[model samples]
Target: MARPSQLSPIAEFARRHDPDRFLCALFAPPERRDALFALIAYNHELARAREAAKTPLIALMRLQWWRDAVAQAAEGLPARRHEVAAPLHAAIAAGALDPADLLALADAREVEAEEEGMPTREAFAAYLRGTAGGFAVAAGRLLGAAPALLPALQRAGAAYGLAGVLRSVRSLAGQGRCLLPQDALDATGLTPAAVVQAPEAARPVLAALAGESLATLDETRTTLRPLGRLAVAAALPAVLARRDLRRLSRGKTVSLDPRSLGDRLAVTLAGFTGRI
Candidate 1:
């Protein structure tokens, strides 16, 4: 049997930043770990590509390549001939997943590729459901979660993903991109450009959205709790992290200072200790 390839540098960076994702993928079935990594690598690379593109058309074209690759992989041609193909190939062979899920993932990328700011709650939720939820559901299938568990897992994943997007406001704004839709800001009588220029003022709105997302995660956590040891082992840290971020946002601090790193790490550790 062939081993999956190593992650590209960019993908490796993404893994480091998203330790929660790395840990979750690690706890997944050994047979599926490589594929999950490959998926993460692809997502990270594609996001970089989209961010760096000079034009939405160019980014969209590149995303099409990944979308087609997923389709071909489902049909056994294994698009791009890279590592993500390994577990995906196996999952397809086992009839554990559908190509549509991968397509949905690609479609979500397509939305991001356009470089349009998220402007409304509906649009933001749609993006989350399609992009973040899509990846989680596909990865969960590979991890051997029954189809019945997918909905709850997806809800949890979307909440987690939303938290990430909110946390990334500072980072993304530096890159000349913003994911918080313009419409939502407009409704608040704030221009999308203004929010991009001054995200601090948007803290209350962002915090409220983050709270809603965490609530969804709470529901997801409750559903998974009865499922036993596997559920707790896989999701507790992320749940704790989300909850911590939610609580931290209540302060609506003016700055996400470096000093906060200790607090974030503490939440992660406490969650790991089951004191969460």
Candidate 2:
């Protein structure tokens, strides 16, 4: 089981390794940072596979590769021999995280590939549990959090995933798709086609999503630990996300502009100070 030399250098770039992602990594033990890096890199790779593929089926095939790699790694095999897989396989051996979670994650990504538009609430929840929540739960074990924390981690992951979907609504709409729940949009007299074409017209939907984010934040309060920096780290992004949604609720649409340097610094400071 020798290590593989193939590493994804691009994943080492600052954006994915940026403060927020690093913040997430903080939950993992310092000794296991390399493993977490490999995991996050693999997650990014799985996500980008769709973008690289000529067809959705290709994306699904790539996802299956990752799932198989996870299984192989869990069984004391070399996984893929890639540099990322080396430390990742070691982590799997050490942590005893089930390979099924990895398979679930890949399967959920495949769902995104097959679906033409944003998922309904139920489908989105299922995806969150399998994908983001799966990662958080795995990370929780690495962080030495008790197993009970898995539910809390899942809730936090779902909240974050929902916020991401809401934020991407504008861009998704431009692609002739809308991520908003049909029921919610219907109540507001908005159609998926209309939202994609006239995102500004979906103000009500955006507002509702903003409110939902707030509720999720409140619901996760009991999960916070006294000095749980990871909890703070996880919640900080939600705060910024809520702020963004509030802006959208006001009038402005979701834009592709990067978060400001000041904002990143603010988040960094808040993360260090545990002020979030």
Candidate 3:
């Protein structure tokens, strides 16, 4: 187990790369916050595996390392020396995190790395469920969420994840990745090349996807309302999702700028209100 002081690196990593989750972790019980940070930091590491790797094979190797590390931790072995892995090992041991959930999240990232674009809305939703929805369920479980609430948490996560994908269309397009569903692109007479070459041509498709995301958010909000405060921490991403959806609906570029005053205010309000 890492000494309390040794966990600071994971905190710093979360604050730098995943500020939203860093803030969300703060809303957890003080004792559980470090574990939350560790879990999310691990998530950040997995999500960025491809970006950090020089090739698909390298990315797969990195992901396999995490998978092996998590398995080892589950078996009560020492964690690897890596910073994220150390804290993640501590979190899994302390929080009783499900190794299967973590492994499933890794698998989703591998699928993402192999794909150039989403083929259908259903496929996109499934991807979100595996990645973001899975994270929410795991985080909720770490915070002692009842088993019954897991499904709702997953729904909220899917909504938030889809919103994030919609917001990142322009940026992802630049990377030769298109998260927009093929059906939407076909309907809008837009292609992945068109999205990158001329983003304006895809506004209609983006707006439609944004609308779908908002509907999912609304459904999730309604479902989670019954769970009350127990769902708040897991649903925190919905704050940013709503903000981005609004901008997308207006045909404005969804900014990934984390320093925006509006984003901070939104997070703060969601934290205080215990909604979304």
Give the winner by TM-score: 3
Say which candidate scores most in lDDT: 3
What would the per-residue lDDT of candidate 1 be over residues 49-99, giving only the tens digit for each residue? 577778888888877877777677677774455545555555555565567
- Candidate 3 Cα deviation (angstroms), residue 179: 2.1
Residue pairs whose backbone atoms clash in candidate 2: 4-81
Q: How well is each residue in 70-149 modelled by candidate 3, as lDDT tens digits?
A: 99999999889998899899888875578888999899887666755677888877899988899999888888777887
With a 3 Å backbone cut-off (N, CA, C), the pairs that clash in candidate 3 are none
The global C-alpha lDDT for each of the candidates, from Candidate 1 onward, is: 0.62, 0.61, 0.78
- Compared with the true structure, what per-residue lDDT tens digits does model 2 show for residues 114-157? 64444466765676667666666655555555666667766665
The regions of model 2 sitting more than 4 angstroms off are 1-19, 26-29, 81-83, 96-98, 116-119, 174-177, 230-236, 249-256, 273-276
Task: Give the worst 10-residue stretch by lDDT in candidate 1.
Answer: 227-236
Please identify which of the two predictions, 1 or 2, would achieve the higher lDDT against the true structure. Answer: 1
